[model samples]
Structures are given as C-alpha cells and as structure tokens.
Target: MRRRAVVFVALALALLTAAVGIWLAVAAAARDTDAAPPVSVSPSASAAPVTADDYCYVEAMIYYRVKEQELAETLLRKQGIEAGASGFATGIAARDEDELEDLRAWYLSWADARPAEPPTDGPCGGHGSDHAQMPGMPSWSALQGFAAAEHPDAEKRFAEILHAQNAGMIALVTLILEGDPHPAVAESAEAVLQQAEADQETLQGIIDAVP
Candidate 1:
C-alpha cells in the first residue's frame, strides 16, 4: 500500500508539470505573436501650387496677344468695315506702305477724337475705359495696318500658332518637373521647349515690326 500511494503522488506531480509547461509555451507564443508586427503610419499627400513665374509668363503673353487683337478689331470697327469682312480683307490684303500709312492715320484720328476720361480704376484695369485705352498701345488703325502689312493672318493663324506652341512647351515642362518616368517623353518635351524658344524670337520680331 505505501508503494501504490507513492506512485500515485509521482503521477500527479508529472501531470501538473506537463500542464504548466503547455500553459507557459502558449503564453510565450501569445506574447511573440503580439510583438511580431509593428504599427505603421502613412504619409499625407498634397499637390504644390503653380509658381508666380508660371502665372506671370502665361498671363503676360496672353494679355499682350489679346490686346493686339482687340486693337485690330477696334480699328476695323471704326472704318465701317464689318468684322468678318475686315478680317477676311486683312488676311488677303497685299502688304503696302501707303495703305498701312493711311490705316495708321485713321487709327490716330479715332484715338484723338476721344477725350481722355479720368481713371476710375487702376492702371492694370486700363483706367476703366471701354477700350482699355492706355499709353503706348498702337492706335486701332495701326494695329489693323500691322495685321494687313506684316501678318495678313495675324489675328487667327498667327495667334493660333503661337498659342499652340507655347501651350505645348508649358505642358511639356510641367510634366518633366512633375517627375514623369518615361525617358522618351521627357526627351521629347525638352526638344519641344527648345524649338518653341526659337519660334518665340521670330514671333516677337513680327510683333516689333508692326507699324
């Protein structure tokens, strides 16, 4: 009877030890599982605004061209010429110094007829004038003469060409600076900018030549 009691006590001790070992293993595993993965935070995304240089360049070019067009349109209007017909006439008209001089005279006359109104708005707003009458703008007739003599297609064709070229150049530059990955695209864009720069000089020369 003593041997049997000793054996029963030994067996109970062994079972308790095994159960404790299993519980310890599970606890260790639970701790390791919880610790394995690290918590992570994602970065916030945002876009940069366009720079002042970009805005200024685009705005100045557009303003300059549109002002020229307005001058041309106004000149045509003053001559009792229908807008569409005058546009067509300018496009097809031969370049003649005498004709251009006559047109300039007409433009100056129209300008002289209007008494200068006091500026209600700032200089940038053309002083609240209907025609944005400011100093150094070629008279409407002079603009018309310029269109007729220098660039018969100045209003439509020349403007369209310049606008398209500039727009493409701007887009290309923007894409490259924005980190476009395609090598071919980046190279093509660079080439376009170079070409457009060259073309810009020619256009400026034409603008300067307008009498």
Candidate 2:
C-alpha cells in the first residue's frame, strides 16, 4: 500500500510539471506578438504648381485692367449675338432673354471693375511699371476694339474667351493663396502676358469674321 501511494504521487507531480511548461510556452509566444511593431503607410505626394498658361491669363485680366474690360465687352457682345442667332436658327433653342441680360450685366460689371491707368506718379508705389512692361503686354485700345465686335457664329470665339478667363482666374487665386515671395511670382505674372497673346489671336479671328 505505501509503494502504490508513492507511485501515484510521483505521476501527479510529473503531470503538473508538463502542464506548467505548456502554459509557459504559450505565454512567451503571446508576449513576443504583443512586442512586434505595427505596419506604417506613407502619405500621398503634393500637387505640382499652377502652369504658365494659367498665370498669363490672370495677369492679363488683373494687371492690364482697361484692355481686359474692353476685351470683355467685345467678347460678351459676340457671345450674346451668337446665342441669339442660334435660338433663331434652331427651334429647340430656348431664348433665355433673362440669362442673356444677366450676361450683359456681368460684362458691364467686368468693365466697371477695371483700374484706371496709373499716373506717372504710379499706383501701388511704382510696382505697377515693373510688372507693366513685362512680356506679352497687350495694347489697351487694340484688345478693346477686338472685344467690341459682333459674332453671329461666336461659339469658337466664346470658347477661347472662356478658356482665357478660367486660366486667368486660376492664376489669380494661386497668387493670392501662395503669396508671391520668389522670382517665380514674376514668371507667373508673365503667364498673364501669354494669355493676352492668346486672347489677341482669338480676337483677330473674330475681327476677320466681322462683315
């Protein structure tokens, strides 16, 4: 009887040791998993700066104020006449007199917004001239007359104006947002000149079509 009791005690001790060893192994694996570093992902890259085309449009509109207003008036008239003619040509074309009237009003608004020519004393502390003579400068009267003509078929002309306007607006917004600190601002200003050149070409096309 004493031998049997000792044998039973020895078996129980061995089982306990085995169970403890298994539990310890599982705990060590759990600890290692918890210590492992988490996976990381990088952020997306920033967008490129606005294009030269965009800058030119804004500069022409904003800096060459008088010329731009003249251009706007001419373009608006051409668009209006074309829109009216389209309504007459296609029975489906609804004459939104109100919309046309609103556009006319906006055209006038564009004209009104222009800054008068700076005196020789200069506006904005003579900073105007430094930017004024920059490349792609348009003659004020020439662009004005170009803007004034009627276009019975002004779809192409209108498209050109719209493109120029959008580019200019984008450049203006960029300048305002980024705050032109470097010489890049001047380069951006030259973009306005480029837009004026484009506008001139479009205007000439319209002039050629005029009766």
Q: For model 2, where is the 10-residue window of minimal lDDT?
A: 38-47
Q: Evaluate all candidate structures by whole-model CA lDDT and list the values in order.
A: 0.37, 0.37
- Compare the candidates by TM-score and give the number of the best one: 2
lDDT of 1 by residue, 74-129 (tens): 33433344344355335422322222222232222223333355334322234233
Segments in model 2 whose C-alpha atoms lie over 4 Å from true places: 1-63, 66-80, 83-182
- Clash pairs detected, candidate 1: none
Which regions in candidate 1 have their CA more than 4 angstroms from the true location? 1-168
Q: TM-score for all predictions?
A: 0.26, 0.27
lDDT of 2 by residue, 66-144 (tens): 3233333334434456543333223211222212222232223233333454323211223253244432344333333
Clashes of 2: 7
